[model samples]
Target: MSSSRIGLRFFQNSRAAFRNATGPFRRPGAQGFRFQSSDAASAEQQSTFQRLWNSPIGVKTVHFWAPVMKWALVIAGISDLGRPAEKLSLTQNGALTATGIIWTRWCMIITPKNYLLAAVNFFLGCVGVVQVTRIFNYRRSLKDSPVETVKELETEVVDQAKAVASEAEAAVKKSN
Candidate 1:
């Protein structure tokens, strides 16, 4: 016999033994449906792939495909590993980290409890954090030298003054 058949036979025999052992302990008015061996046999005959495909969290459901689709983000993040830290966008990575954390938690509270989605989101958050940390450290290192810090402050002041002057010029032009 095939391994599946052998396993099914063992299961059936154990169930029967359990039912016999518990028969005397049943309440007088208690009623319950029993599975026929044939029904169990037919269910076992169905392939594992078929069973999974028909299941609640199977390929047909959004729970499955959504995680599959979200994997692209993880892949993209991984690909960015070679990218320069200076080129990394803090806001973009921050957004990914926030969404990943939020959705990973949401996955547990939602119906069917999509663990696959949670796993993908968790990895995505990890990738985002790694990139964010790299960017933050790179920016921090740039200001480590006093001269660089002074230059940055000077540039900020100059930029702000330019922006204010431009805004005043625009306001005067509009009033005229």
Candidate 2:
């Protein structure tokens, strides 16, 4: 009739109920639920997507999403095709190239072997190489033709100065 005795009785009943619900196969100290035949059959009836959702490299994991997000870099590189080669940074492209090559190989070496990651890295490496080549060729051409390079530099400076002046004028007009 004591509070402690009532708690003990409740605990005993709960344990007995759980044991009955779980069936006779489970050990007293067992950690997890043991699936019965019905449970096993239901698991076997799981859809492909449900199976994939629980898989090691499935959508629930970072393994499936990292490469998906990294695709933006590839798209950005492709978009950079329209930009002048002289504007591209040699260091940036070189870093991308190195990262792509290194990760591409590492993807294959890692457990679960993400082929999608490998493909993305390969394309990223190709884009980086192309950009690097363009920058190198542009610099080489500038070095080859000193007079043209000087003219080009002067044109760029003048254009930038004009753009700044126009922006300042617009700001003044807006203030007025």
Candidate 2 residue spans exceeding 4 A from truth: 1-44, 145-176
Clashes of 1: 0
Q: Could you tell me the TM-score of candidate 1?
A: 0.59
Residue lDDT tens for model 1, 122-151: 999999999988876686688767567556
Clashing pairs in 2: none
Please report, in order, the local distance difference test score of every candidate based on alpha carbons. 0.80, 0.81
Top of the candidates by lDDT = 2
RMSD of 2: 13.7
Worst lDDT run of 10 residues, candidate 2, spans 29-38
List TM-scores for all candidates, in order. Answer: 0.59, 0.59
